[model samples]
Target: MPVRRFVPIAAVVLVASLAACNPSATKSESDSKPAASASAGTDRDEAGSSAAPGAPAGGNGLSLSEAIAKIPAADEVRDGYKRDSFKHWIDEDGDSCSTRNEVLLAEAGRAPEQGARCALTGGEWRSYYDEVTVTAAGKLDIDHMVPLAEAWDSGASKWDADRRMRYANDLGAERSLVAVTAKTNRSKADKDPSEWMPPAQSAKCTYLADWTATKLRWKLSADERERAALETLAEGCSGTAVKYEAAP
Candidate 1:
């Protein structure tokens, strides 16, 4: 009986020893490695996300005045500027919605119903340029915040066709393209702040901010008169801030 009992005791000790040495023998030990790795991965992900708010790291928190000061002052050249130099209103995603339609769709006060081929109907829009309210889409024009010609005069004349195309159809910034009445847009055609401003008195400050933001975004230069005009206009827009993302 003593011999049998001793053999059983030794077998139990051996089994326990094997379990301690074998990774697969204990379920908790096997799961602990993956669990620790997952926890480390989670910590890394949180760290990466914490740094995202300041990312894109282009231009985030600049006062309107400070932003305007960054644009280099130069003489504007209208030479060789043509409307066709920049191709626009493209269906960039083949969604059948042209850049023009896309702007209209986004700025509509009442969302329009989209149909086959991106046909839009039954929407209301408030044209901030003139403060006009309209229900018809045809009456609206998608105005480039910085007109193509103005862009050309500033510095885009030197850019390649592809870059010019991107400028013309810039949807990356909400302020880059605006929906406004056709009349107001035509009235402001190819004119900088020095020559034109929104007819609505309330919209002037916002307009200046938009113009400044767009110029800064594209690294566009401002002429002497244009800069002066911007300064004068900015005076009325106290406590205003400009935010923009640099164009790629």
Candidate 2:
């Protein structure tokens, strides 16, 4: 068998590895490549999109003001924040389903059934990781920006499953939301922003921005190495980008 390698990491590969083992991760060569690739890409992306939020006018991406402005302040909540507290993806219409699948359908641009369950009926995904385009639902995976188990390690080990569900199904934010090829998602599984990112070189700034934003929201603190990695990511927020959010 040919040894699979990743230029960057992404959703599919990470997801599988997250579930296949655990976040402490004994990830395979197939598993590690894309997540690392994507994670690195988000750190890089000098050649970016004009409309991508991270970059500035004729430049790379956003400034610290944008990154700070967009992030919900850690002190805003009086209540404790834990991973298990957010109840997510319950069958909204009383069908046998969950919200996580609904996001998969929407992210994939698929029109789901009345229940909005994950049937993966129709959608087209051009995976930035390996540059593969897929139409089948099975080919795509809905990824959580913060992996559940990783959350457990971070602070979520204490919350109830319902709360965990909410974190799992949170689709309200662009940073926390995305759809990617199944292989990439599986490979990502449950890892920190420090551990993985997207595979598209063009998407680097946005990836880091999302990472920073997600970390801020969860009130999760990064170790020194993680913080240093994020500082490097901050460099991407240069061209064509502006302040990211309205006061939160």
Candidate 3:
């Protein structure tokens, strides 16, 4: 395997040839090249879309104003935080696929072969975070929009195991658990919007919306800095909207 390189963040046009809409598309070695940055000034509309009021609006839902209003602001607590506290990747549906595999299957642009024990092979995926297309299943990582550790600091530290598990394995919304290239996922490890944004500039609006919706759904608090960053990002995403149900 070759090491992947990170590109500087800049807006770039998306090649329609690699669009996620093509289920039969296969990734070539050239497809492994870094993606162009997302378009920053694009104006997408969600008018009359069936998505809930808090759900992602055209993948860029809810104006920054509306999304920020939903997040409860508070100081974070990090004392006694541990990664193992939350149980994840369970086969909640008893389909033999773990939560990780389930996300991969859901997000793949080109479907892969599923073998015994739900092993996946030969799928094509479009990683929205950095706009990278990958052919192998092993190259992707399912990322928690609001990372578990960040959640702990925000409020999950007080949650019971069951609640934490529900959050960890959430598959209810498309924005909850995202499948992205391992490089982008690792680059985002445990950071909030304040510390990181997707390398793809076009992804910023959707990323902010997803981050906000996840926090609102899980009732997670945002620290002052994180909230400020989200607010700033939202301002740039003019027509976007967000609709998320409160977490049970």
Q: Which one is best on TM-score?
A: 3
**TM values, all candidates:** 0.76, 0.56, 0.77
* Model 2 lDDT per residue over 122-163, tens place: 655545444566666566666666566555555555556655
How do all the candidates rank in terms of TM-score, highest first?
3, 1, 2
Worst 10 residues of 3 by lDDT: 1-10
lDDT of 2: 0.45
> What value does the lDDT take at residue 232 in candidate 3?
81
Each model's RMSD to truth, in Å?
A: 23.2, 13.1, 9.7
**Alpha carbon lDDT of each predicted model:** 0.65, 0.45, 0.67
Candidate 2 residues lying further than 4 Å off, grouped into runs, are: 1-89, 93-97, 109-118, 128-131, 158-160, 240-248
Between prediction 1 and prediction 2, the one with superior lDDT is 1
Backbone clash count, each prediction separately: 0, 69, 13
Query: What TM-score does structure 1 among the candidates reach?
Result: 0.76
Among these predictions, the greatest lDDT belongs to 3
- lDDT string for model 1 (1-248, tens) is 00010010000000121233211232222112111111100111122221212212322245557767988788999899998999999988777888888777766667789899888988888777776887889888889989999999999999999999988987655557777889999999999999999888756666776788778778899999999989888876554445455677
